[model samples]
Target: MTTNLPLPQFYSQILSTLQPIFDDTLPLSDPSTQSTLTSALDNLYLIQRMINSLGVFSENESIDEVGEKEIVFMSLNWVIGAAEEKGGLGGRDDRLSALQRAETAYTSYLEILNSYGVLSPEEQAESSAAASGQSSTPKDPAKKREAKIRQYKREKELRENIANSLPNQPESSSSPITFLLCLLPSTSNRPSVISASTGSTSVNQEDPDEVSKSTAILILRLLHTITIASLSSISMEMELLSNAPASIVPLSDRDPREVRREEEDNTWKLDRQPSKYKPRELISGNGRVLRPFTILPSTSDMSDRERLKSGVFKQSWRLPTMTIDEYLEEEQRRGNIITGGGQASYDAPTESELLELAAENDGSALAEEKAEQKRLKDENWARFADENKKGAGNTMNKG
Candidate 1:
């Protein structure tokens, strides 16, 4: 069933309902929340359809030229909602479907932004590369950082400008619905997505567009990871099952590490076994032995009455090869500590930073001294340069 209300009224009613839900005064798990949210989503979709049908925006028309940012803003919000909905869908089929939907929705959103001059040049290039399945070349870190900061400020302004322009019901007209002009959620209210690579939230966006785009990318990435993990688990289970019918198929040779881990896990199920090797027999008295006898040969002949006795004390430890000082001396000879790194080279002044700094601090004596030194250096270089022209060093040809 359609809302059947006028565009502004319908838009206002939906956003008004969404504000509390997004702000979290209304619990997501509450029975009423689902219907309300679903209705809002459906209406937002319908709003886009109606707006498209109105022909305010035409194919190949720039958003800037036509002043259709208000319509476009509503469209962006709808795209965000749609991507979020698909991303939140649970299970294998849902997860698989979500990525395609997210890609389509987000790609169109970015294309619109690119056309409107909202996206930076780098972002536009990246979007094009992504669409074409080509890799973008690496850019200077500083330039990329500067571009991101500019884009951040610009996007924020664009969002605010469009949001504030949302039409309100006229003062004369006593309509029940009023355009709530729902701004993007505060930073604290936005969900934090832990990055797979960095293990932190990559984009902490107050703007729903940024959040939705990041969330969609995350959803696709997570789907890939989940599929890989599930396949690995299934493979392991298959391997275990294959081993059960070993008579038909011999067990495959597994990695020693795998076998060791498996044995470790099943150690409790193993029976105790006797050691194959044992310590040598002590000289305990045995059957048929009249008296204790030494295993070593005697140095001198002795009478039968006399018996050899073993010494109680013998050194078991090895003698030291060298003293601590001798060891230290050897190590020093071998160069124990690394040395001689920064002593040979320093950060030489090859730029105009020194001149700029001296100009900035003209009142200081140090600055005056630096300025004098720089002047002398430049004067000497000038004299040398003027005396020896380019190619003057090629004396072999000259002579």
Candidate 2:
């Protein structure tokens, strides 16, 4: 019962421009309205065709995977916006129940997006760390709140500054999209992603990449949902078959005991189960529960010696199977070699040893050395005296 899905061709940009007009003129079915509806449908079909070109199987995709695609989101947005048009799929006034059902389905889909948490601690810290070139893990509740506050303040200040710097002209508010763009956070680095901005909203595009990524993701998620809804019947049939027993296996042949055992095994246990031993609690001297001591790492701890000293570091790989005696023996051998097998003493040198060293120093043929020096000094003095006397005699002769 599978029909070949039609591939429509039209530019996304062109189709996007007509959305407002369609919304305004809906509930009417004149020639112009019909033509407009036809054109819009054509545009939607074209976009779907382009998306179908990717050959994605909705059944095989996880929600996250589908969410990451742009076209799926676009398709979903289109479905939500145009599904209730006068002559569209859920258009009949008499089929109000069907429209309500569709709305419920779409709302459920949106809940998935809405239920997403704000930037998680890890994500926020990672983004901050990437920007600041530091690892910032906030362990304390107060610090975590402070980090979030700081992030919000920083982003707000950045946006305000950018807004203030823009030319103060009437064109500043001319486009809702541009206004929204001006409202985007300054931390965003992608300004080119504004190409996907829909429904006459010209984004200020401070960060095109961020806008584009966000828009693309939104569109992809929508498309994924639309695709899923379209194929839900098929999916249900498959699911039923999977859960059904094979035609070859009759229900009567199954063992009742085995079925009962499986049922018992699959049953959930009670929350307060009986334990083999009573629970033990440590109490403080004052009678309160004794909580174990905990260390909360500070910024200084991350940047300083504490970080280096905190963790246990292994210098070598250890074989877990090695015996403690073997390790101790190896250590003893190394220790003996290093310390000279108890030959080295911690005691200081005695007076006797000091005196012995001094005596050895002077006793080493020292008398001969001193005598030689004295002899050299006397010979030099006698030579000088003889030269002086000769000089005196010469002077007397000259006179």
Candidate 3:
């Protein structure tokens, strides 16, 4: 015959009782308080019997029941001990204080039950043997020491392996200037004063686009300065070393510009310009020194009427004019060119060449004549078609 168990109901009662004790707003005068307190006391008694049923201590209680009881007992004891040690359950008039005290006493009882339940049959035998003055051989001390050493070595090896598995990080280049540059405003208000001493009229007033461009230029300059400073420091360090490689010592000690050029040459291979146009040497007024041509705007003093009549304002195009040497220098600085090639082949088209090209394409009067002939032909065709349609309709009506 099978016997029904009351374990589920018992566990449910314990949970239901403990739930109200954890609720802060529940009043002492409330009817549920009496029920809650009664349930709590009853659950504590049931828990002790449950431990006895578990054969955790020499068949006195089953293993499962004993384990569950021991866990709950230890947890409750810890909470109650903490609360009492903190002096959090001393007041008499406070309902929570009284509940806490009750719970503490229950916890202490549960701890005693747990301690009794944890004493295994072998341990009890050992204790009895000790009380009777029967000497039992102790465990080997050397083996225990060896085991501890092996455990420590295993843990150390595991930690080292973990550290080695992590990726190596590059050295940080953070500095005060880097931090300031990062925090600098990307764009500033227009008409910013250059200095306190400068008048308002002397200030550089920039729109949003100009402000952004200027800020970007400033950041690039700062980065360039930091790179150069770092390179110089490395050079100084190399100079102090006695056994440095010859290449390292000489290259490191070179000027920042030369170092930059070497670095660029290693990274970029220059491509030759396309060869469609013939290159020309620009001559200066002295006739000996080659000079670049400069394109200037027509004198700006002309009236609006005069500018319109001359068609100068309507047909004008603006081209950037800079010396060939200056252009070559800029290209070299940008790593766009390596060789100091003499000059650019491309030049601005002259005024006479432009006028000749326009004259070659001119067909204004001939186009007008063709359009007039087409219009007359279309008008005559329309009138003849209308007359033919009227004659056909009259003939059909007469028949």
Best by TM-score: 1
Misplaced by over 4 Å in model 3 are 1-9, 53-70, 76-399
Query: What's the CA error at residue 76 for candidate 3, in Å?
Result: 5.8
lDDT digits (tens) for residues 293-399 of candidate 1: 22332424544444223222322432222334544444556566465557363564444566757756868988887787778888999999999998889988874
TM-score of each: 0.35, 0.25, 0.19
Per-residue lDDT over 1-399 for candidate 2, one digit per residue giving the tens place of the 0 to 100 score: 222433311232333334444335344546666566556555555554555577543544444454332323323333533443333322323234334444443343333343342233444344333323232436699997886586555444434443334422113113222322222332222122222223243323344333334443423332333323333332344456556554443347878887787557434221233544222222233446443222234533276566466334422332122234543444555453254334345365654454445445555666455555556666888999987875576855675
Worst 10 residues of 1 by lDDT: 169-178
User: RMSD in angstroms, candidate 1?
Assistant: 32.8
lDDT of 3 by residue, 1-399 (tens): 111435433433343334334333455445666566554555555554665676324435533443322333323332232222223222323323434453344334333333444333543343333323342223588865664465355434433332232122101222212111222222222112222222233322222222232232222223222222232333343344324323243565679898887777534222233433222333332444253345323435557777467444432432224445655654566566665334452365554454444445446765555555556666888998987875576855674
Q: Candidates sorted by lDDT, descending order?
A: 1, 2, 3
Ranking by TM-score: 1, 2, 3
**Lowest summed lDDT window (length 10), candidate 3:** 169-178
Best by lDDT: 1
State the displacement of the C-alpha of residue 141, model 2, in Å, after optimal TM-score superposition.
37
Clashing pairs in 1: none
